[model samples]
Structures are given as structure tokens and as C-alpha cells.
Target: MIIIQLNQRQQKIIEIVKENQPITSENIASMLNVTRATLRSDLAILTMTGILDARPKVGYFYTGVNQINLLGNDIKEKKVEDMMGMPVVVKKDVSLYDVIVEMFLSDVGSIFIIDDQENLCGVVSRKDLLKATIGGLDINKMPIGMIMTRTPNVVTVKREDSIVLAARKIIEHEIDSIPVVDMDDEHNVTKVIGRISKTNITKLFLEIAGE
Candidate 1:
């Protein structure tokens, strides 16, 4: 169930091709007052989605398939690795103040802590920091390791995991984000590479809604 809410140009392209079957891309571009390069991606998307049929040396033909916006299949196929953002990682030995500073600078709700081997060892969230602050802990003197939620207690997602799986973990753990990790089977450790958060999933939902 792939959803394709056609934009104005795409719909217009469909109409143009519908009116003039077997029309060349060059003529379509001239009709739309845009360059062939500008319509290249749109044409490609249309053809791939079965909205338009293209023939080499010929032109485009309307397939009589209107835009469909069901989003299930595409969403289900999305993986965490491709969608995850660069993670904000700091050494476990770093001061709590340094971690806080980095978190603010990066504008992330959570920060991943790495060990000397650069493997993920712990995670800290804004609520965790706040709790530490409330406990009268001195951020300047405290090591991030002391406050982090250490693994294997920390929740994580593999690069091959589906976005749906990642979203489920976030909801279950009630955390803002989860690290995208690669497991070292021989060493029994995981290395953090990326992160997925509510914001990312929200954007995906918005796209699905065609809003």
C-alpha cells in the first residue's frame, strides 16, 4: 500500500499525457513551461508508480491509474538504518556538564555514551539529567557514566530493524530516541552508529497523511 499523493506538477503531467498519448518528454516539458531536467524525477516517479507508461524513442502514455495514497506497504518496508540520523555520542568518562553542553548544542533529547573501545555502553535522557540535577549532583564533577542508563539495560535497534520495530521500542521504553547499533557477536558488545526518534516517525506519519 504505497501512497502517492501527486503534487500539482505531477497531476498536471498526467493530464498533459492523458490529453496527448504517446507524447515525448520534450513536448511535455514545453507544455509545462519547465525543463526536461525539472520533470525528470517526476516522470520517473510517475512511471515507477504505474501512473504513467514511458517508451524509449516514443513518449509517455497514461495508465489510467489515478493517485493512490495508502501508506502501509511503504511504511512497512522502511528500515531504521536508512532513516536514522547521526547520533550524538560522548565518552563515558566525560563530565556530566560536558554531556549536557553537547546535548544542548546538538538539540537532542538523549545522548549515547561510548566506552574506550567506541562501543555503546550507556544512554542519558533529558529526564535523567533533570533527576540528577534535582538530586543536587554537581554536573561539573560527575562523570556521565555515573548517571547513564548502562547497557545491556539500554534499549537499542539494529540497522536491519524496521522503523516500525524502532517505534514500538520507543513507545514501550517511553524514551525519546533509541540508538541504531551494530552488534559484535564475538565480543558480545554493540557499537552505536545512528539514532531514531519521535520526530523522525512523526514526519513519516505526516507524509503518510499527505499533509
Candidate 2:
């Protein structure tokens, strides 16, 4: 059982809402001597945590004490596809210099490497590029494939997988992002459809927390 500790403000908000059942955000704001906008974030967090439930044209009501447990289960059940973003990809034969430019232009920490058939082949991260450049390799002549972490080594997740599994892979591999791949009949990677990064996971959590 996981216990989510509430902040002082959140605790206070819960107290106020419990004391005044079905209270409006505006009224709660007045009681706290703060504007409704100011309390919006706190309200969101409370609602997301299940500590407070909002009704249309009504007000907020206390749900129950086990809200955090329910929220935790909800997060665990969320699919990776729901949170994946479009991948930043590069051709295997593209020059390292071009790869660098694309990476910077896309503002991504890593890039997926693909073959002419668009099959997932490899992945290149910022560290991989930095190491290659620092080794005095001719960036203009070296193809990105030469420096990429190739297939059979690349960690990948599928669309149907859970976001929790994606997060675990990210942490265990110590990588900034993982490619979300589509599979062929033989279970080989067929295409790079999307990517899951630490930022994506963080944003998902914040979005759920009503941030």
C-alpha cells in the first residue's frame, strides 16, 4: 500500500472542503483570503488525488480516505501509447553532422535510427554524439549508424504496454528516452511510431496531479 503525503496547503484545503460540504471554488477562495485562480492548482491536486470530487453546477464533496490508493492503481493501468510523443528520427546513412543538426533542431535528447525500410535499427543519444565528436572523428564523413546503439541492444516499448513498464525501462537503462515501436509478425521492430521520454512521464504525472 502506497501512502501519498499531502502538503500543508493541500491538507488545509481538504479540511475546508470537508467542513463545508459541496463548497464552491469561489467560496473556498474567499474563506482562504485568496483568489480562485490562486487556489486552482490546489483544487486540481485535491481532485486528482480523490480527496475532493467536483460536480458540474454544484460544488466539491469529499470522496473518501482511500483516494491515493485508487489514483495509484489508475496510474499503473495507464497505457504508454496514451503518453508517447512523436519520435525524432534519422536515417542510418545520414552524416553525423546532419544528425547533430537534426537533434538540435528537434530539441530532443535522443534520436531513433531507422533503415531505408523505416525499420527500427538503432538509437543515438546526446552522450553518444558527444563521445564521437570528442574522439576527433570526422563528423562530416561519419554516418550516424556508425555511432548509434544498434538493434538487439536498443530497449523498446510497444504501444499496448503500460506506462509503468516504460518508466521502469527508462530508469533501468539509464537512458533519457525509449522508442515506441511497432512489431512485425515475427516480433521484429517494424516502425518507430513514437517515443517515451522522462519529460513525458513527468508531464503525465503532473497532469494527473492537476498541476
Candidate 3:
């Protein structure tokens, strides 16, 4: 990949995000007295360089690139189980509308779906819900199971897995989160115990850098 040096505008963008974090692209452009179209490439470069964090429906925030290297060495061997957040689960038979309410209440991207056995069966993402709701389907009575990405297709990590591996899987899959699971060899299924998300990893980096 060709290296593109950070220009003065990019630097100013970083400073802007640092001060007024979670600022939208429109706002950032207005601050710089430019159109969002003019700022797009610059914003793209900054984010691609790990200098800024962009969240959909949210906005841009500085990821503290300077401190990222501080935790680079320490993060490789960290265990995901120690850092993963509590799993958010919903019964497969639960109404899609109910799941949507829970998703907003919990502020999570993906919600794990379980059967009567409470074993991990599927995963439903915010995108999935949005797409489902865009059309006038009876979501009030629609079951989440009908729309979920069934397991075996779901990417996951074990509690004992390294944080590096979890990070890799997340990047490779381009998913918002991965369920930390426990295997049931006898039953040949996985149980969702926790979830490791981009937010969790970001916090882990910040904590490590602080330490």
C-alpha cells in the first residue's frame, strides 16, 4: 500500500474530533468551511490510518492513535474472556419488535438468539432488523428466528482465545461483535457466554495505554 502523509487539514480534523468527539461529518465539514464531499477523502484516510473512529448512526471520534502503539505489545496475549462484555440474548420465538426494543435498550449492535435449550442458535444484527422493518412486514408478531443468521455460520471465539485472534476475526468478518462461546462437544453446539465487540477492544486499548 502506498503511504499517504497526513496533511494540515487532516491534522486539524483530528484536533476537531478530539475536542468535539462524536461530531458528524456535516459538522466537521462546516467547522473547516468545506463541503462534506471535499472532506470525504480526508476523513477516509484518517479513519483508515486508525487516527479516527467512525460509528454508524453515531459520529466520528479520535481513537488516540499516538497511544495505540503503547498497548500494541501488551494486547497480543490478552484473553478475551477477561475482557468480553455480557452477552445480550433473545429467545428465537421473541417478536422482532421486542428484539428491536431490547437492542436499543441495551445499545448493542448484534443480539444473540437462543432456543428453548438456551444454546446459541443465531445472531441478529441491527442492519438485519433495519432491513426487516423497512418493509411493512408484521414485525409485531414476526419471530426473530426467521430472520437471524443461523449459527455454524456465526463467527465466534472461545473464552480461552487470545484477544489478537478475536480482533483478527472481527476485522476479517467485518462484524460489529463476536460471541465468546463455550463448546458442548457431546451435543455438538456452542453456548454464548459473552461477546467481544469493537467497543470492548477500543476500551481495552485505552485502559492498557493508561496503565
Ranking by TM-score: 1, 2, 3
Q: Which residue pairs clash in candidate 1?
A: none
Model 1 compared with the native: what TM-score? 0.67
Over the stretch 25-86, how does candidate 3's per-residue lDDT look in tens digits? 99999999999999999999888778899999799989887734533444667898889999
What lDDT does the true structure give each of the candidates?
Answer: 0.91, 0.90, 0.90
lDDT of 2 by residue, 1-211 (tens): 2546778877888898899989999989899899999898899988976779999889999887675356456778889898899999989999999999999999999999999988989999999999999999999999999999999899999999999899999999999999998888585547999999999999987877679
Candidate 2 — which residues are off by over 4 angstroms? Answer: 1-71, 187-189
Best by lDDT: 1
Q: Write the per-residue lDDT of candidate 1 for residues 1-211, one digit (tens) a residue.
A: 6445679999899999999999999999999999999999999988988889999999899988645442456678799987899999999999988998998999999999999989999999999998998899999999999989999899999999999999999999999999999998899778898999999999988976778
Model with the higher TM-score, candidate 1 or 3: 1
In model 1, the runs with Cα more than 4 Å from the true position are: 2-71
Instruction: Give me the displacement of residue 12 in model 1, in angstroms.
Output: 33
